[model samples]
Target chain A: MVRPRYFFSETFISLRRNFFMGFTAITTVAITLFVVGFFTIIVYDIQGIISSVESEVELAVYLEDEISEELKDYIEKEVLSWEETDSVNYVSKDQALERFREQNEGSDILKEIEGNPLPASFEITLSSPEKIDQVALRFYDKDGNYIEGVNDVIYGKNYVNKLFSITAIVGTIALLIIIVLLLAAIVLIFNTIRLSIYARRKEIEVMKLVGATNWFVRVPFLFEGFFEGFVGSVISIILLYFVGNFLLIRGERVIVDTMRIKELAIVGSSGVVLYVYIGVAVLGGLIGILSSAIALRRYVKI
Target chain B: MNMIEFKQVSKIYEDNTVALKNINLEIKKGEFLFLVGPSGSGKSTFIKLLIKEIEETEGSIFIAGRNICNLKSNRIPQLRRNIGCVFQDFKLLPNKTIFENVAFTLEVIGKPVYEIKIQVPQVLKLVGIFSKINSYPHQLSGGEQQRVSIARAFVNRPPILLADEPTGNLDPGTSEGIMKILSRINLIGTTVLMATHDRNIVNSMRRRVVELEEGEIIRDQKRGVYGD
Candidate 1:
C-alpha cells in the first residue's frame, strides 16, 4: 500500500489549485458558527435579568378595624404556623400611621388627617418567594372573599411567574434557533465539500482508473475538508471573542467589566468555547470531506 | 500465448442502445492489435468493456488469465491498472504538470516516490515529452498532450496499452510520431490494443487488425491493411 504521505500531498495540491472555493467554504462555516455563538449570548443575557427581579416582592395582609387585638394576635400566630411563611412583620395602626407620615415627608396633606386612620398590617415574606399567590389565599375574610382592606400582596408572584414563563419561552426560542443554525451549518459544510469534490472530480476519476484503492482517493479529500474546517473554526473563534466582548461592553452583566468581554469571550467561555471550537472545526471538516467523498461514489469508475 | 481473449462479448448501454454485438477475438502478448470501425460501430464500447469502463451485456472478456466480466465493481480499478488507455481528447489532467500527470498512474498504484521519480521521466522520454515535464496540459500542443497521456498510461508499466483513437486530433506527422512511439513500446514487448480508422497508419504498420461493422467483427487478420 502507498504511504499516507502521498495522499496528503495530492490533497494539498488539489486544495492549492482551487484556493478560492475552499476559502468560500470556510467562510460559510464560520458564519454559521457565529450565528450559533451570538444567539447563545443573547439567551443568557435575558435569563439573568429575570432572576434578579424575583428576589424582592412580599405580600401584605390588612386587618379589619373591628377585629379585636387578641384575634389579630391569634391570626399572626396562625400565619407564622405555615411552613411556607419565611417571616411575618406586624404593624399596628399607630406604627402604620407613623410610617405613612414619614414617607410623605414634604407633603402638608399628612397633617390634615387628624386621626390615625390606617389599619394594622402584616408583611408576609415567603420561603420560595414563588408561592405568594397561595399565601395570599390565607388572608381571606370569614366569607372566603379577598380581604376588603388589603392594599396589596406584592410577594414575588408576578415577577417570579413572569420571569419563569418568559425564560421558558425564550429558552425554547433559543433552542429552536440553535437547532436551525446547526442544521444550516451541516448543509453548508456538506455542499461546500461537495463542490470542492466536484472541482477535482476528474482527478478523482483518474485516480480510480489507475487502480488507486478507495481509501487512496478518499483520504486526501477528508484531509482537505478537515483543513478547511480547522482554518475556519480558528477564524470563527477569534471573531467570536471580539464580538462577545463588544456585547459585554455594550452591557451583558454576565460579561464582567474587569474582563474585556471582547477578549474574555474566548477566555470566559474557555472550556465550553474550546470544546465548541475544536468540535465544530473537526465536525465541519469531516462533514465537508465526507459529503464530497460520498458524492464521488457514482462518478469514480474502475 | 494470447494475452487478451474475448468470448462472445456484447454491450447494451443503459439507454438501451446496443454498442457491441457478439465480439470474439484474441490479442497476443508482444503484438500490436488495432480495432477499426466507422462511427458508432462499437469500437469505443469494446474498449470500455476491456477496461471495465462499461460491463459486457452478456459475455466474458479475459485479460491475462482473469475473466474481467465476472470481476466485482470495486475490482475494476485493479483491472484498469494492467491496461493503459489513451483517449481521443488526449485527456491529460489540465491542472497537473506533464511529469506529474504521467506519474499519477504509478502514484495511485502505491509505487514509491523514488520509483515514480525514476520511471515517470523514462516514460515521458519514451513519448518524446521529457523536455516538457514541467508544462501543464494546456500549455502543450494537442499532439504533445497526447504524448503525455500516453506517457501516463505506460508509466505504471501496464501489461496492456489501450489507445482509443490516440491520433484523432493530430496531423499525419504527429500521428506517425505517435505510431512510432507505440511501435517502439510494442517492440519492447508491451501489448497494445488501439482503435483507429486511419488507413495509411494501418497499411504502413502492417500489424494485426480487427475490424468492426455494425457492432460485429467483420475482419481479423495478421499484417492487415485497413481491411473491409
Candidate 2:
C-alpha cells in the first residue's frame, strides 16, 4: 500500500511538471479515439443500408406470344402457390398494348404503329430480393427442361454490386485512419513518458543507488501510463456519445424527418458500439503503457 | 574467508579500452573499506563489476559464496538489492521530498505501509534530516541532500554499502561531516565501501584502505591512513 501510494504520488508530481505534455497526450488520444468512433459508425451504418437495399429487388418476367390463356392462368397459379413468390401481376397482350399506348401517347412511334406487337408480361415480387437470381434461373425450368414460354428475366444486380463496393471503400478508409491515429497516439505517449522520466533523472538515479530493483522503480511509471490511458478513454467515450447523439439521432432526424434510431444508445442495443469503443480504448491504453515501459527503461535503469 | 572475492577480473570495452585488468581482491564483512584511486583507475568499473552492472571480460566475482559472474541477466536486480550504493552527485530525487527519498528503498522490496512510515522517519532522524523531511532536493543544501541520499541507502539496511566518491563535489567541512556520518553508520555494524581521494578526511579516519593504480590494487593495509 505504501509503495502504491508513493508511486501514485510520483505520478501526480510528474503530471504537474509535464502538464503540457500530458495535455497534449490526452488530446491526441481523444482525437484518435473520436475518429475511430465516428468512422466506425459510418462503416456499420453503410453496411446496414447495403443489406437493406440488397434484399429489396424483384424480377419482371415478360411472357412469349404463343402461350395460350389457359396455360398462362395455370403458370400464374403455380408461381403464386410457391412459398417464395410474394405476388404476381398479369397483363393480357391487349392490356399491355393499351397500357403501352397510354404511356407513349405523345410519341410519334406509337401513332405510326398499326397493330400492337408487344407481348404481355408478369411483374413478379419475391418474398426476398436475394432470391431474385434463384427465381430468375428457375423461371423457364420445367420437367427438367426449359418452358419456352417466358422471355428475359431482369433484376438489379449492378446496384447490389455498387453497394458492396461502397461498403468496402468505407471500411478501407476507416482502417487506414485508425492505423494513422494509433501511431500518432503512440508517439505522443512515448514523448510524454520520456519527458516525465527526464524530469526525474536525479530521483531515479538515487533509487538505483539505494539498491532498488529496476522494476520496483518502474512500477510507478507504468501505473502513470495506465492512469492516463484509463482516464483518456473515459473522456473519449463521453465525447463520442454526445457527437453520436447530435449527428446520428437529432441531426439525422432534421434531415430525414423519420429517423428511428434510439438515442444513439451509449450502451447500444446492438452491443457492437459498446464493444467497439472499449476495444479501441483498451488498445489505446495498452499501447500507452507498453510505450511508456519501453521509453522509461532507457532513461530509468533503477 | 572474504565476503567478496574478485579473481583475475578483467573488463575491456567494445572499442578495446581496458577498464580493469587481472584484478584480484577480497572484501571482508564488518570492515569499513576505502578504495582510493584517481579518475580512470577503474574505481567506477570495479564497483560496477561487483553488482554486475557491466560483466568482467576475463574472470569471476564471488559474493556470498556465489560466483555472480555466471548469474543470468534477470538475477542482477536481486543481487543489487543486497548491496546499497551512493555516488558523487548526491543522487537524491529532486521531485520527491526528503522523507519519500528515504522510504523509496523499502518500498522497492514491497514493505508494508506501517513499516515504511516508521522506518522512513527513523532513518531520516538517524541521519539528522528529520527536520527537513518535507524538503525537496533543490530546497536543501548539498550536505542535506547527500544526507537524504544516505538515509535512502541505509533505510533498506543492506549489509554492504558502496560509496563511489560520495563527497567529491563537497567542501572540506561538508566532506568531514559526511565522513563522520559514514563512520557513525559503520559503527552500527554495516560494512561500508567508500572510494575517495580526499587526503584530509582519509588520514583522520584511519580505516582499512585499498589503493588502485591503473586497474591494479597496488596497496592494502589494516588501520590504513592517507598515503601516496
Candidate 3:
C-alpha cells in the first residue's frame, strides 16, 4: 500500500526546505565520484600501455651464414610449433643488409660496407611476454651452448624481466588505491546523510506521533538520498567525459610524438567510456541508499 | 467497554527514577477525562504509556480490550494509528501548510488522494481553520496553529485522542476556544484524555478529573472541579 506520489512529494518538499544541506551532500558526492572516475580512466590507460609494450617484446635468433635454406625453414617451423610462440618471420642476409641501408640512408656507414656481412635471422613474437626467456632458450642445449647452425639469441632478457615485475606492482597499487577511494566515498556520504537526519529530527518525531509506520517515515528520506546521489553522479559523469577526453588526447599526443612510442598511446574507445560512466553512476546511487539506511536506523525509531 | 485500561502499571527509568507506581485506571469509550497534577506528578508519563512511548515495568495496559504490554515492536505503529495525539507547542510541521499538516496524518496511513482531499478540508473546517488551510504554521497565530494541529489529530477519526497541555501556552480566551473545540470533538463520541494545569479549564469543564501526586493517583472524581 505504498504511495509513490506522496513519498516523492515528501522527498521534494524536504529537499526544498533543506536546500543548503542537500546542496552540500550533492556537491560532496560529485567531487568524490569525479576523482574516482578520473583515477579509473588513468588506470585503464596505463594498463593499455603496459599490454601494448608487452606485445612488442620479440626474440631475434641469428643464424650461421653458411646455413642451407632447408635448415632455415626447419628453424622457423620449430620456433612456431612452441605453444608460447605467436609468430616467426625469417629475414635473409640480403634483407638485413637492405634494412641497415634504409635505416642509415644518408650516412657514410653504408658506403663503408663492402659486401653483405649480416647473418640471416628469425624474429619470433611470443603469446606471453613473460615466457620470452624460455622460448629464446629453446635454441640452446642444457650445457648453454647454441645448437647446430644457430649463431646467437638476443631478447634483452634483463629489461623484459624488469618490465613484467614493474607492471605487476603497478597493477596491485592501482587496485588498492581504488578500493581505498571507494571506502572514503562511502564514509563521506554517510556523514552527510547523518547531518541531514539530524536537521529533520523534529519532523521525524511528529511523524511517529501521528501514526506513521517506521517505513512511512523512512521512504521519503531514502528517496532524498537516492535523488541527491543520482544528480551528483550525473554531474560527475558529465565533468569526467569532457575532462577525460582532454587529458587522454594530450597524453596520447605526448606519448606518440615526444617518446616516439606509438604503442604507449591510449585508445579512448566509446565502449570503455560508456562502461566507466555506468559504473560511477551506479556506485554513487548505491552509496546514497546505503548511507541513508544506516543513518535512519538510529534516528527513525517508531 | 473500556477504551483504555491500566492494571497495576509501573514505570521506572534507567536512572532508577520512578515515573509511575502501581497505577490503575480505566477510561471508557466516548468519555472525556482530565488529568490534573503539579509539576513532576507523572502526568506526561500517563499519556506516554497509553501511546506505548515508554513501556510499563509491571502489569498490563489494554486498549480496546487488547493487552498492549506484550504487543510486538512492529505492531506498535498499528496500535498508535488507533490513537491521535496533540501537544502544547502545537507540533505542526513548520514547512507544511495547514491543509498539508492535516492531510499528512491520513497520508501516512495510506489513505487515497480523493479521500484525503475530502477529509482534510472537512476536519480543517471542524476546527474553524478552513480559511487558513493554505497558510504555513509559522504564518498563523498560536491559536490558529493549535487549531491546525487539532485538525491533524482528528483527521483520521481515531477511537481515542490524547492532549498534553493543549492550552498551556494560550490566553484564557484562546484557551476557551480550544476547549470548545475539544468539547465539540468529544460530542462526536471520540474519547479524549487531556492532561492540564489550568484550574479554570478544569473547573469550567466539570468532567471526570483524575489528579496525580508524585507518581500516584491522589483523587478520582466524577464532575470534579480543579480542587476542593
Candidate 4:
C-alpha cells in the first residue's frame, strides 16, 4: 500500500515534468482507441445485417403435376423430418395458379390460358441459408437424378452464392483493416512511451546509482503510463458518448430505412455503451502498461 | 568485522579486456582508505565491483559478510541502500531540488515520510548545505552540486561510503571542502573507500592508500602518500 502511494506520487511528478510528451502519449492513445472502438461497432452491425438478409431466402421444390397424393405427402413428410428444415408447406396446383394470377394481376395472359399449367410445389424454409445446398441435394440422387415425384428444387443458386461470397470478402477485408489498425496503435503507443522514458534516462541512472530497486524505479513509470491511458480513455469515451447520442437522434430514419439496423443496437442499448467504454479504458490501460514495460528494458540494466 | 572482502576477483569484458585481474583486498569497518591510481588503472571497476554493477568474471565479493557476487539481482538494490555512493560527476537529478535529491534516496528505499522529513534536513545540515537545499543542481556551482551529492550519499547513513573521484570536477579549493566532508563522515565510523588521482589531497591526508597500476595492487600502505 505504501509502495503504491509512493509510486503514484512519483508518477504524478514525472508526468508533470514531461507534460507535453505525456500529453502526446495520452492523445495518441485516445484517438487510436476511438478508431478501434468505432471499427468494432461497424463490423458487428454489418455482420448482423448480413445474417438477417440471409435468413429471408427460401427453397421452392416443384412437384410433378401428375404425381399421386400419397407421393406428395411422403416428400412433404421427408422434408419436414429433416433437422435442417425449418418448415415445409405443400401448395396444390389450383393454389399455385391462384398465387400466379394474383402476383400478375394486370396480365390477362393467365386468364386466357386453356388450363392450369402451374405445378404444385413444396416451399421450404431452412434453419440457416448456408444449409440450402444440403437440403437441395436430398431431393435428388448422387448421380443428379431427380427423385421420383420431384421435378425441380430451386433456391436462386447464383444469388445465394453471390451473397455468401460478398459477406466472406467483406469479413476478410474488415479483419485485415482491424489488424493493421491494432498494429499501428501498438507502435504509436510504444514510441510515445519510449520518448517519455528517454527524457528521464538521466534521472533513472541517478536513481540506480543510489541503490533504488528496479521495481522501485519501474513502478512509478508503469503507473505514469497507466494514468496516461486512463485519462486518454476517459476523454475518448466521453467523445464517443456524445457522438453516439447525436447519431441516435439525427440518423435514426436513415439507419432504419437504408442500413436496416434495429436502432443501431450499440447506440440504443445503454448496457452495450457501458461495456464499450469499459473495454476501451481497459485496452488503453493495458497498452500503457505494456509499452512502458518494454521501454524500461534498457534503462534498468544497471 | 570486515566491511568488505574480495577473494581473487577478476573482471573481463566481452572483448577480453581484463579490468581487474586476480585482485584480492579487504577493508575493516570504520576504516578510511584512499585508492590512488592513474587513468585506466581500473579504479572505477574496483568501486563498481563492490556494488555489483558489473559482475566479476571469476571469484567472489563479500560486503558486510554477504556474498555479493552470488547475490540475486533482486537483492542488489538492498545491498546498494546500505552502501552510499558518490560519483565524480555529482550525479544529481538536475530537475530535482537539493532537498529532493537527498530525500530521493530515502524515498526509493521506502522510508517513512516523517523519517525522510527529519533525515533530509539533518544530513543537509551536516554537509553544511542546509540553506541551499531548495536549489536545483543547475543553479549551483560545481562545488555546491558536489556538496549536494555528498549530502544525498550520507542521507541514509549507510555502513559504507564509496566515492569514485568525488572531487574530479572541482578545483583545489572546492576539493578541500569535499574531502573534509568525506573525512568527517569517516570519523563517524563509516568505512570510506575513495579512488582519486589528486596528489595533494592524498599526500596531505597521509591516510592508508591502496595504489593500483594496470588492474594490480602495486602498493597497499599504512599512512601512504599519493606516489613515489
Candidate 5:
C-alpha cells in the first residue's frame, strides 16, 4: 500500500546499491540475446538460401529438332497442369543458345557452328525438390515410351538428394542450438537477479518487520528485474544494429557475388529489422519480470 | 475495556516443543504491562503470537475485541499495522537515515508526503533525536539507534506498542532513557507491553508484571518487583 513513487525509488535505490550485480545481470542477458539475435538472422538467411537452392533443382526436357512449335506449346501446357509442377517454361532454340553463350562467356565454339544446334527445351520445376524423380518419370514412362517430341530428360539425381539431406540436417542442428542457448540465457539471468535480491536480505527483513505488505516488498524487485531485462535487450539490439550495418558494409559484395544470391542482405528491410529489435526488447523485459518474480520469492515473506 | 486478551492459547512447534501452554491473560486499555521470563519460558513466543508472526496451535487471541486467530493470512499486515512493535536488536535499515527510517512506517502504510513530513520530525523530537534525523543507523550509537527505532514505531500512533526486550542491547543508563520514553508513550493512552529480563529496571519501575515459567504464567501482579 505504499505510495507508487516510494516503490519506484526503492527499486532504483536497490538497483544502484547493487550496481555491480545489476551490471553483471544486464551484461549476461545482453550477450545471450545477442547470440540469439545473431543466430536468428543467420537461420533466416540460411533458410532463404536453401529455398532458392531448392527452386533451382529443375528438370530440363530437350525436344526433338523436327518437333513443331505447336507440340512444344502442348508439352508446356501439360507440364504446367501437373499437381507437382510449380512452373513450366518453354525455351526456344535461340534462347537456349543465348543462355549457353552467356554461361560460357569467352567460348567461341558456338560461332564455328553453321546454325543453332541447341534444342528447344521445357524447363519443369516442382513445388518440392524431392518430387523431381517421380515427376520426371511421368514424362518417360516405365515402358520407355517417351513423350512424342521429348528427346531426353536431364535432372541432377544424386546432387538434388544430397542437397536436400544436407539442408535438413543443418536446419535441425541450428534449431537445436537456438533452443539450448535460449534456455541457458534464462537460467543465467535468473541466477543473477536472485543474487542481487539475496544481497538485500537485511533490508527486506526490516521492511517486513515494519509491516510492509507482500507486494510492497516484492514489487521493487520486480521492477528491478524488468529494468535489467529491458536495458540488456536495448544493449543487445544496439550491438546487433552495428553488426548488421557492418556486415552490410564489409560483406555485402562477397555475400552477393559468391552466393549469387541477394537474400543474404543483412537485416532485410528497415521495418523488419525494427520488428526484430522490438521483439528482442520485449523478450528481455519479459525475462526480467519473470526472473524477478522467481528470485524474490524466497526472501519476500508476507 | 481490555485492549489485549488471550484465551487458552497454546503453541507447539513442529518438533513438539511447547512454546506456550494453554494460558489466558488480559490487559486493559492504556495500561503498561511487563512480561518477565527466562529465555526458554515462552516470553518471545507470547509476543510473536500477539503479532501473528506464528500461529497458535490451539485457542484464540483477541486484540482490541477482534479475534485475530481467525484473521486471514493476507490480512496479517493489516493487523500488524494497528500494533507498533520494537525489537531487541533495533531493526533499523542501516542505509536509511533516521528520518527515513521513521518515515518508512508511514510510507509503507501509504501516508501522504505532507503527513509524513509533519509527523516524522515531531515523533523524532519526542524521542529526543530530532537533531540527528539525517544520521544513519550505523553512524548512531546503540541508544541513538534504539531511539530511532522507537521513533519509527510510535510515529504511526498505533493503539498498542509491543517492545520485545527493547533495551536488551543497551547499557543501564541508556536503558533508563528508553524506558522513560516508553513510559511517556504509555501515559498518552497507548497501551505498552514490554518483555524484559532486566531485574533492576523491573524493580525501579514496579509496573504491572506478568511473569512466565515453562510456558505458563506464575504471577500477574500490580506494581510488582522483579522477584515478587
Candidate 6:
C-alpha cells in the first residue's frame, strides 16, 4: 500500500531542511517559465494581428468599357462559384467614378478629369487570403491571356507575397526560440536536482541500508521536484497575468489609435489565456518530474 | 538452518584490488559472531556482500537457504528487509527526531501507523533512549546517538543483524553500552554479526571470532579472545 501521508510529510520536511537549494530550484523554474510565457503571449498576439490584416485582402477584376450586361453578370457569378470566393460585388463605371471622387474630395486632380476613366470591376473577397493568387489566375486563359471581356486582375501581388513570407519567417523563429528555451529549462533543472541529491547522499545510503525500496527512497524527491515546479509555474502565471495585461493593453491602444481599428483582440478572450496558463503549468510540472527522474537514476541505487 | 553461507566468495574491485579473496564461511541461526580485522581487511566487504550492495567477482552466497549471488535487483530490498544493519557513523537522519529515526524502518516497509506507534517506542525503550524520543540526532551525545541507531536497526526485528564497527567512534565506556544493547538484541534469538577492531570488545565477549588479514580469513575459533 502506498502511504501518501508519509510521502507528503517527507517531502515537506526535506524541502524545509534544504531551504536554500529548494529556493534556488523554484526560482530557476519560475524565471524560465516566465520568460517562456512572455514569448508565447507575444507570438499569439502577433499571429492574431497578422490574421486580422490578411482578412482584408481582396481581388479586383477590372472589366472592358463596352462589355455586355450579360457578360458582367456571368463574370460575377463565375467568381462567386469558386470555393475560395467569399463574396463578389460588381461596381459599375459610374459607381467606381463616384467612389474615386469621394476619396479624392477637395483635390484639383479630380476636377481636371473630363470624363470618368475608372473601369467597372468586380470586387472579390476570398474565404482564405492564401488562395488569392490561385483564384486570381482563374481570370486568365491557357496562354496567360485575360478571359474575354476581362481587362486585368489585380490583387496587390507584391504586397500579398511579402506578407506571406514574413508570416512564415516569424512563425519559424518563434517555434525555434520556444524549443531552445524548453531544452535549456530542462538542463538547468536537471543540474539543480543533481546538486540537491548530492547534498543528501548520506540520507539515501542510510535509507537503502534500512531496507527501503528504491521507490520508497525516491518518491519524496520526486514529490519535491513536482512541488517546486508547480509552485514555480503558479508564480510565473501570476507574473504573466499582470505583465501580459499591461503590455497587451498598451499594444491594443497603439494598434487601435494608429490603424483606426475599433478593437484589437491580441490573444482572444480571457478564456484562451486561462487555457494557456493551464498548459504552461502542466509543462512546468512535467519538466520538473523528468529532471528529477534523470538525476535520481544515478544517485538512488538500491 | 544456516542464516548465511559464503562458498568460495571473492570480490575483486575494478582496479584489480581484491577486497575479499576466495573464501568460505557459514553462520547458523541465532549465532553471535565477531569479525575482527584491521582497516584494510575484508570485514566491510563481507557485510556489503550479504546485503547485495556489491556483487562478488566469483562464487556464491546464500542467506536463509536462498542463493543471493543470482538474486534479482528488485528482490535485493526484500533480502535487506530481513537483515538489519548498523554503521560506525550511526547513520541517523539529522533532521528527524529520535522517535522518527527508529520509526523510519517500519515506515519504509509499509507498516501501519498504529503498528509504528507501538513498535517505535518499544524499540527505543529497549535501546534505553526512550527518554530522548523527541530529541534530534544532533542534540544527543555520541553514545545516545548510537543507541538511537541501534533502535532503528533492530526496530523491525529482522532475523539477522550486521554491525560494522558500530562503536568505532565511541569511547570504551560508550562502546560497552553499545555492546550491551547488541547482546540484548542477540539474546532475542536474532543472529548477530559484528565487525570491529576494539580488542577489549572482542576479548570481553569471548563469543565465536573470525579474524581476517589481507582479504583472507586467518583464524576462526570458538570461545576466542581478541587474539590466539
Candidate 3's residue-wise lDDT over B92-167, tens digit each? 8887788888998888888999999999989988999999989889999898888888899999999899999999
Best by TM-score: 6
What DockQ does model 4 achieve? 0.74
Cα distance off (Å), candidate 4, residue B14? 2.1
Give the interface RMSD of candidate 6: 1.0
For model 5 the local lDDT of residue A201 reads 82
TM-score of each: 0.78, 0.84, 0.89, 0.94, 0.89, 0.94
Relative to the true structure, candidate 5 has a C-alpha RMSD (angstroms) of 3.2
First chain TM-score, candidate 1: 0.68
Q: Mark the regions of model 1 whose C-alpha exceeds 4 Å error after superposition.
A: A1-12, A54-158, A179-195, A253-287, A290-302
| Full-model lDDT, candidate 4 | 0.84
Residue pairs in collision within model 1 = A58-A155, A245-A261, A245-A262
Docking class of 1: medium
Number of the predicted model whose DockQ against the real structure is largest: 4
Clashing pairs in 2: A203-B93, A214-A302
Between candidates 1 and 4, the one scoring higher on TM-score is: 4
As for candidate 6, its clashing pairs are none
For residues A1-302, write the lDDT of model 6, one tens digit per residue.
69999999888877887788778878877877887787777767766777777777899999999999899888887887899988888899999999999999999998798898989999898889998989989989999999999998898888888988988888788788878877887787777778878878887888788878889888988998888888888888888898766877788778767876544565546466777788889988998899899989977666
Tens digits of per-residue lDDT, candidate 2, B1-228, equal: 577888999999899988888988888777888888888888899888887778789998998778998897667767877887877887766656788777777876778888989999988888888999888889998888788878887887877788989998899999888888888888887878898888887788898988887888888988887686
The CA-based lDDT of model 3 is what? 0.87
Candidate 3 chain B minimal-lDDT segment of 10 residues: B91-100
Q: lDDT of all the models against the reference? A: 0.77, 0.78, 0.87, 0.84, 0.85, 0.87
CA RMSD, predictions in order: 5.5, 4.6, 3.0, 2.3, 3.2, 2.0
The CAPRI class of candidate 2 is medium
Q: What is the DockQ of each candidate?
A: 0.58, 0.51, 0.67, 0.74, 0.55, 0.73
| Candidate 1 structure quality by residue, lDDT tens digits, B1-228 | 879998988888889888888878988888899999899998988888887767788988888977877788678778888888888897678877888888788878878889999998788888888999998888988888888888888888888999999999899999999999999888889999999988889999998999998899999989998964
What TM-score against the true chain A does chain A of each candidate get?
0.68, 0.71, 0.88, 0.88, 0.81, 0.95
Candidate 1 per-residue C-alpha lDDT over A136-201 given as tens digits, one digit per residue, 9 for 90 to 100: 876677787766545444455555677678889999998898788767665665666667777777
Residues A1-302, model 2: lDDT tens digits: 34566678778877777888888887777777777777777577656655555545566777888888887888799889878898898877899899988898889988777777887888787776556656777776766544768776667767655666787888898889888988888788888888888877766765665556677678777877776766677778887778764675554455334444333323245677777688768976897798789888777654
Better of 2 and 3 by TM-score: 3
Task: Find the 10 residues in a row with the least total lDDT in model 5 chain A.
Answer: A262-271
